[model samples]
Target: MNSSATPVAVDMGSSSVRVTAGSFDGARLTLSEVARFPNEARTVAGRLVWPLHELVERTRAVLSAVADEGMSSVAVDSWGVDHVLVDASGHAVAHPASYRDARTRGIPDELARRGLTAQGLWSRTGIQPDPINTSHQLVATLRQLAPAERDDVARVLMVPDYVAHRLGAEPGWSRAICSTSGLAEPGGGRWADDLLRELAIPTEWFGDIAPERQVAGHFAGSSDVPVIRAGSHDTACAVHALPSAPGPRVFLSSGSWSLLGVETDRPLLDDAVRAAGFSNEVRTEGGIRLLRNLTGLWILQECVRQWTREGVPTTWAGLTRDAVNAPGATALLDPDDPVFQTPGDMPARVRDAVRRNGGRVPESPGEVARVVLDSLAVSYAGTVRQLANLTGANPSCVVAVGGGTRNDLLNQLTADACGLPVAAGAAEATSVGSLLAQLETLGEIGPNDRSAIVDASFDVRLYEPRASALAGLAPPNLERLS
Candidate 1:
């Protein structure tokens, strides 16, 4: 294994795409950023869709920037569920629809109409039934297409798989991410055959399912450097980068969507798991990620976008500082509310939700930021408790990773709300984990020791739960809403 070769990790997130180069000297891994660019869904012909060609172009530009850096290999990971439909010639049939698109609005009711329930699906696939899941999206696609058009579909590739295919890798599905489709069987590479038959989906639409850490192929022009299948699912990669000793520790991959969960050797498939709103997604390493998807920093991110559109461009640090001293929990709206999921006038929506909840409406940008952060913390706290109870694993601490960890206010509030210490670090976790998985595939590092390598590679900022922050705020009782 040549430690001098710097491997590349491409993280295609919902909001942005980032590339990192990692230098591993057979002992420690050091990561450096190569490129970053914003990615947004576009409204074309009255439909919201991902700019697939534009994304491919940006990724190529990023890869080109590091093409001369003695690059050993490259791997990619992306947000889960959404995929592209390709024809027999490997051309995308159409622009991929946004996960938040309204096409699948009545999918749950449709499933019920067919006598297929969430519990029935969960028991077989271990995926919680979400309208945004690829299964529902495929259904929408099928309904939108004529029977002749449906016959033209050859493959359905998830976002990262599509990106990886463009990089000259074999067209294969990463089970780590495919698990989120609500179609794959838990802890296995096989698809849920019965579910697929029931939904009238062609089993041949999916190609070979690849396990994590395998070399898919070489980059398009390079023969020596292998492109590894490193989780492919962004949250799976982020969880792989966690620097924790073998112990009871919860992980919160906080970003646009806060996926808070724990890793287990087997899927927790039960009625309680479904009732608790926790999803059992497959892990990069061999296990299940029992977690809940809480609406995360997206509310605040949208608010910033709105303010910038109104000629008040602001940085996250600037907004955090402004809200740091603002009143806490004066208004608390459920961050997971359906209205907040779609993109729009977020600041106004936050204010309206707060007012509707009998709390004071945010009159300023700072107040709006504070309300969003406080609401997110409240949701995180409640989800953590539910995760613990469902899994029966009382973790000693919560490991917060990704972009949201930099927000001091949210970290402290989460710690206070959960009554547990928080260790936040690895802001570039998804990329780092991708690189680590690549390293393991190249035999530069052992598979079992990847966690220890991560533990020694990065620094962590610790926060102890402070009772003062939770003094007056009432923790969100989601159960009461049920």
Candidate 2:
């Protein structure tokens, strides 16, 4: 233990919750992990429940562990859109809904019938409007439930705020996290009242939350902890993990969904981008994470899950290795195809997507794996080019971060397709980011310090793009096989 004081930042995700303790040392940050909890949404009696009480128990347990470790302060952040409904007594009124549910589909269309444009929504929220957004979900809730239950609902706060309330602290919610809720404004830190009213969502459901730069509130966890808003958005925390490249760069946080995009100072709401499945997620410092959400390795993961269920003994590592050795790619699926969105028969859907696009379907698990990886690389290249055009920042390098960067095949394919150097690895990018954002929140790190610390702690690899692949990046397919 460093004899020096420390602060803890908590990052809560759909899958897990993490507590990292540290303070920046100007040039670098010293971080240590305290605890992690297995988290997932469960459906009981046909309602998706977050197990908020259990999560709080875990949070206190982790903080108790951190206290035992002698760490100083603590903070919290979680995935966006889902929120806890608080009753007048300040107790949780209802369990938060997961974004993965199918209920939000028709609300946007229904609202559009009432003259609400998604483009207008983009400009207001500076966020890509998705049906799974909180506003849309709320509308769906109204349509499905009794008016009395809806009337009984009082205040609503996102996940982190909900946790803060349990800690007996004045919930200082983070607007940065709120920005991704598809309900909050993208550029402005305030909630978009007009959009809320237009969607017929109760404007009073939300409360004032500060931007990421400001310290939200204090959490008295063993110590008087200042709970900073550390880029309350999970993706924002993950992006913070990417090394600060010298020039412009596109980062692919590949996992269940490939978050592909470049960071921008302004929102890109042009109809073409919107039509192309692009949306703006907020960055930590109020920038727009101009991105397109592609169904990424989740298909590969599900394929493996099914294969394992069938006793084929496939794993992520094994699949990646086999995919690298597999002969070639026969076809590609536009990553945003809705067929691959939900959980069900993934392989069949993959084959169908390829077949419909006039592409060859895979015969074996290896081919299907190759098909998915190669298509991701191709998609990454296309997104990189679009990001450069959209931001006018010619990124000479594409930074592939997150767990998927370990795949040698995908990295090299991305390098070749984009004709740019691919810097891959730092598999713990999201964790580091979540931690660093906390350190920054505690007044220990600044923007300049963030770059230096990441450069020192992370082992980053680079793969140069092939000239042959650049030639094929024309209006048509000159695609490079991963």
Candidate 3:
């Protein structure tokens, strides 16, 4: 790699795709977004599927545009679980199913009917038995295909890996993203063969898991720029940018989902952990990210969408301001409530949920938004306490990352609810972490230098807890919503 070369991180998020270029000086790493575009899955032939071809073309254009700027390498990171099936020629056999697709809706129950209980699956994969899991999605897909068509399914690549392969990287599963699929052994970087056999999924479709930071091939096939597997899973990449702190580090990768958990040295597969809906996902540097995948900003986003459709558009800034001034939420919702799962009529659904829970129904949009924000904070606090109990390590503070950190009301509420100071920043955490991984892999920075660079490069604001704010909020009880 040239000394002045820049590494670009292609962050493929569920809602958007961002391509950012990073230049690291001796002390600070400066990042600038080269391109960004909206990314969303749409109904294609009665199934919700990602715009894989469009995404690939957009990413390729961005990379090509930046290729002449002394680029050293490029890496891709994206949301986990969703994947694309490819043929021998490396072209997608079909558009990748969105995790939100209803095809996997009852697959878990179907699996249980076959004697593959949720606990059994968790024991093998250390992943929560969610229908959104890749294993369940594969089961649904395989059951839908005829025997002859199934033969055409040559490889199952997670979204990032598939994108990288399309961009000229070698065909290989990146470890961090593979770990999210519920098909691989927790923290082991190997496919769970026993589980695959039990699920009747073809074992040949998967390849060896590649390290998070390794050169797979050259970008665009003929370019000198290398395509690195730098923390392929978005959460793993975000966690990579975490500033070093003592004791167990609790982090909230707040986005469409509120992934709240602490880093562990190994998978915690005990019954208690599973019972609490916790999953042991793999970290980029090799460890278990023991966390609960909770519902996050999706509800609010859905509400905004519906409002816009109803001829009343709402902006994030206005919504946050309204939520701040609104009265306390009369009812606390379990963000994971099934009612809020799918998009459409979100405000009405929120009111229905509150009514069902015997709480006052919110009449206005601000009130509805307040209910969601309050509920999320309460849930965050509860999850943090659960992490401490399960791991036996008291965290010093809560680290909140991703787009959700921009909401000051939610950040302060989380601090108050968790009863801990919240260090919130790195709005582009996934991209930052991917860049850090690329820089480290290219020998531009040492392993220990990530924290210092992150601190110097980003503006992390600390929100102190205000216990008084918790007075009107209801206690967290995940079971009530379940």
Better of 2 and 3 by TM-score: 3
lDDT per residue for candidate 2 within 1-482, as digits (tens), equals: 12255767677866667776765555555666767787777886676667888889888777776667666456576767788777776677667777777777777788778876787776666556677777787778777656676777787788887786676556555776787777776564778888788777788888886777555555554335565666766677778777878777788886666788888777777766765557777788767788877667778877876777778887777777777676655677766566666656777887887777765778678888988877777777777776666667888677777767877777887788777888884665666776676666555666767767888877788887765433233212323211
Taken over the whole model, the C-alpha lDDT of each candidate is 0.84, 0.71, 0.86
Candidate 1 error regions (>4 Å): 245-247, 469-477, 480-482
Clashes (N, CA, C under 3 Å) per candidate: 0, 4, 0
Q: Rank the candidates by TM-score, best first.
A: 3, 1, 2
lDDT by residue for model 1 over 135-230, one digit each (tens)?
888887788887777888898888888888888788889988898888888764788878888998888898767789899888877788788898
**What is the Cα-based TM-score of model 3?**
0.96
> Which pairs of residues have clashing backbones in candidate 2?
8-73, 125-185, 125-186, 126-186
* Candidate 3 local lDDT, 1-482, one digit each (tens): 23454899999988889999988776777889899999978998999999989999989988988886668899999998999888889988877889999999999899999999999988988998899999999999987877766778898999999999999899999989999899998775899998898899889999898888789888884568999999999999999888655555699998988888988888998999998889988888888888888889999999998999999968999999999988874677778877788767999898887877766788888999998998999888878877788778888899989989999999998988878889997988989899989988889888888898888888989998886465335443455222
Ranked by lDDT, the better of candidates 1 and 2 is: 1
What's the TM-score of every candidate structure? 0.96, 0.89, 0.96
